[model samples]
Target: MTTSAKRLDSAARRAQLLDVADRVFTAHGVHAPLDLIVEMAGVGRATLYRQFPDRHMLLLALMERSAQWLATRARRLAHRDDAFFRLLDYMASRIVRSPALSDYWRTTRMSDPRFSDVYQEVLNAFAPPVARAQRAGLLHADVRADDIPLLASMLAAGLRGETDAERRQLVGRALCIVQRGLTPSAPGGCLPGTVNDLS
Candidate 1:
């Protein structure tokens, strides 16, 4: 094959691999076998190894994809006039939609330093919006940019209940408390259905 054709083929294979990895990782966690990913991706073992030298490399790729997915969600929710509230709503909706993300997060943290680096890169993309929200007096001024990750952890912990309804209530109550603390002057209490505009 010509060089150009070779490059295109490589790009296509990479995309296909990542798509399949997403499904397998979500269902089986990061510890899932390499053969499982290869089978799911419909690629030979040689092809998988050629693309990703080892399991770590494949996990890193998946982490990058997951981070980009999250940053996209945050950007979409950043449209509200109140940047702070919008960010909180975005995070709340994100938590509700993908409870599995926390598992991936823990896996990333346990992986190589490069994994943490990529995770931070993705988190940074969403930080500017949070900062802007704080500046607009919509988000709690005391809430530092670094606190977002901690907040995510706390929210995820609260959502670790047995039943879906219990998890939902935990998340809702956590968001309400956080929002209220952020907007003390607002007369009305945390009403349901108002926060998750981005959802």
Candidate 2:
């Protein structure tokens, strides 16, 4: 094959591996067997190794992709004038959709500088609305930009629930409490649809 053909093949194989890896990792965590991923991807071991080299490298790639997707969503959310509420709503939606955030925190090696860098990028992506809310006095006085991470971490735990119903209930409850705590007292009570309430 020509060099151009080989490059295209390599790129196609890498995309296949990532698609398989997302399912495998979600089911078995990041340490799932390399042979299993290669088999599922319908690619040879050589192709897998050529693309990812190791489990850590594959995990980092997944993190990078997920972070890019999330940054795009966050940027859109920040366009809303209600930065505080929009940030929390964005976070709540993430908690419902992505279980990997919590899984990565629990399973990945925290000491890995690459992993730490990815986590930092996620935090920075989440910071804009949080900082804006603070400046606007929309968030509680005690809240810091760093506090958004803990909120996300907690919501992520809710998503790790064993069953679909459980995950839904947990996230719903957590979001309620979060919005109540963050809202200014002037808006009635914690009832949903009220000006101050956040469901």
Write one digit per residue (lDDT tens) for candidate 1, span 47-157: 988989997787677667766766776677676546545555556655655455455564344245676676676567667776777667666667766676666666666
Best by lDDT: 2
lDDT of 2 at 90: 57
Quote the positional error of residue 143 for candidate 2 in Å.
Answer: 2.2
**What would you estimate as the lDDT of candidate 2?**
0.68
Q: How do all models score by TM-score? A: 0.72, 0.75
Runs of candidate 2 exceeding 4 Å displacement: 1-12, 83-101, 106-112, 186-199
lDDT of 1 at 128: 76
Looking at model 2, report the run of 10 residues with the lowest lDDT sum: 190-199
- Taking all chains together, the TM-score of candidate 2 against the true structure is 0.75
Give residue 14's lDDT in candidate 2 (0 to 100).
79
